[model samples]
Target: MSTSQTEGLLQQLLQEATVVARLSGQAIISFAWLWPIRGVLYTLLHPHVILSVSRTLFTSLLTSAIIFTVLAFFTYLPQAAFLSIFTGPLGPILALLLVGAESVFLVTFFARALFLEPALSQVFDTTLVSRGQNSLVRDGKTKYASSTKKEGIEGALVRPFQALSRDGLMKYLLSLPLNFVPVIGTVAFLFINGQRGGPGWHTRYFQLKGWDSARRKRFIESRKAEYTAFGMATMLFTFIPLVGLVFSFTNTVGAALWAADIEARENLIESPRANAPNSPKTNEGDVRAKAE
Candidate 1:
């Protein structure tokens, strides 16, 4: 392309990188409260919330470990050769490939456990209380009615696999070529993966809210910008070497915080009184009339 076009592309790439960095930084800051030990403790303490999902978590970890080990073993010779010759680009490419292999499953798996289920349970329980309903019973004799139909653990367990299917698989494949593009490619990968991964964490919330597949698609599409930011931050976190595992859990907590913020905003907007601060109040009028 022409000089101006090249310069514009460079600028665009810089801007995208900046956005990813900012979002990643914000994610770290937002989730700083739940880092390391705190996040693990939170998950462990909430047995009622996390026990059902524990099997999926263990399966994901075991599968990812096996896949990562196999990939590392198979790629060792090629990776060593590449490192000896062209250590710059090929080095990162190999790392990305290996990590991506496991991350395809692990990231979604952790997101579901750390963010979706817990957040849905918390949000739904709060919603029930707001509606004058109880999720639990104080008396041993009576059980509380279910607020929402449970979709089953199998569906949640299979989500990462669904993400690896035709449509979902294509986005990841398309992002691979970008890894060769130097600095720009890395940023592009972050943006692309973040965009793809953002909505997966929200899957549990959608299911819990009783949104069917079509409605979930529509709602996610409508909030594309918000989820893109979320996904970008998550993608950046996954790019970190060792800490990414810990951050996976934190990402879930961050996702819940994000969902709670969204619900709070929606509730504020939906409240009639919140929208009409100056409107006359019947209680005030009645008290004045009684005094007069």
Candidate 2:
């Protein structure tokens, strides 16, 4: 290529990179960052959350510790080595942290299966009530609730699932290699996962509101930055091994709080119509559909 042409290409690439970096910075600086702190404070203020989750606390930690030990034994050295290729002296320490994070992530499947899921649902509902949205389950309708086909809405605002599916875990595994490139790699890993996870928390909300896929997509697209911010904050808070256990509930509270706020604002604009809840209805098909 000619010298001028190459220079032009290089300048264009640099501009794109700068734009991406600026957007990333904005995403990280949102009110969503405070959600984790809100979660922590909410946990302390509401013993109900702690009580509900405490049933499996010992089992969850012990199980996580065991899984962490075994996985670190087999994978630590290799992971550290991979990280060291790009991180050099800091690699081992970062690898140790990542392994711990992975162990915690893996054990969530068991923890959720045994107790965490229901506890989170309870926490979400409790937070919703506290935030003045009690009508979420009452006669099944309120000005603050979605006016769509929520007749089938039940339980919490989110459907239950393990941390990530095996396929998602494999994708996460693939992303881990990004850690080889130091700070940028780690940010990429977190950002990618956070992006998906942020919105996943609201499938039930979307369905409860009776939003079709297109409307839901537009709503999410408009707030993509904030959602990613929430997700990234959630990932970081939950990445801390044993501490993740508590953060999990707090994060749910935070998301519920956010959702409540959204509904509240929308309710102001919406006419004061009410729809009753289909309290007995189940949401297997639509929930999964919206989530996908």
Candidate 3:
């Protein structure tokens, strides 16, 4: 890269790092943005939301154990040996933690893809109903209803991929190499991934709002700090093996509760964007025109 390009890259990384440090205060408020704790409480009260966990628990644990052992066998010794160059004595413990985290991440990613989509959508919609945002759920069902194909939340699941973004997955894969940098590298990996993880918790809400990409971008950017904090928190909580799978559901409920609150406050539950006949066709153009 040229001098200008290199300088620009450094500036970008610094800006991203600054984002976490700056907005974490907003996240500390406990009830603002996506209050993850609320999700846990909500799940505890509603046993149905956690039904998805029971289904995936065995598979998630088995896969985690298999991956953990494999990574330990092939990677632990070398990764620890490498870290010893820096920490000397702490290398073995650190390497074990890193391997476990990596296994959890991989299992969480694939396991979510294979089994969690339909169940998660149900969780969000169920929470929405509890929040008295039943109309929004009806709207989603009507919009996606097809006698020949799948109906209701099933249709919604494919578009948002149960809140999993392909671009985000690609970014995550690119970030995995960051683990090689030792301790700072591990922190960077978590921080970088957390940037997207928080916003991901809201994908269902965005879809329900019928938000175009530009509009969703604007909303998330406006509250980037809060989103980053939430994402970082999710990453930390869900970074554990086997147990992280449970946080995944809680976070979904939390996002739904947050979405319901937004709808209630803004009267957005009955908004035209979600109800208008041509919303799907016009939203992108409308968002661009407003931006201009």
lDDT for every model?
0.49, 0.64, 0.64
Q: In candidate 2, what are the lDDT values of residues 1-292, reduced to their tens digit?
A: 4677556645643453454355587686666767767877877887675565576555655665677778788998998898788789889877876886686567656665666665666667677666666555343434225543455444334532222555445445556655666777777766666665677666556644656779989998888778777877787776665455556767877877777777666654442332235334424432222222
lDDT against true structure, model 1: 0.49
Superposition TM-score, candidate 1 onto the true structure:
0.54
Tens-place lDDT per residue, model 3, 1-292, is 4677556645655676677556656655633434677888888888676674566645655665676677778888998898788778878866766775666556655666686656677788888877677667777565545421542333435222222355445445556655656677777766666666667777777766666689989998887766766666666666564456556667778878777766665653344665678665434422332232
Candidate 3: list runs displaced more than 4 Å: 1-15, 18-34, 61-66, 72-74, 77-81, 88-93, 144-170, 173-186, 268-292
Q: Residue-pair clashes per candidate, as listed?
A: 1, 1, 1
lDDT value, residue 222 of candidate 3 = 86
Q: Each model's TM-score?
A: 0.54, 0.71, 0.69
Off by over 4 Å in 1: 1-52, 80-98, 101-154, 157-163, 211-218, 236-250, 274-292
* Candidate 1 RMSD to the correct structure: 10.6
Candidate 3 has its poorest 10 consecutive residues by lDDT at 155-164
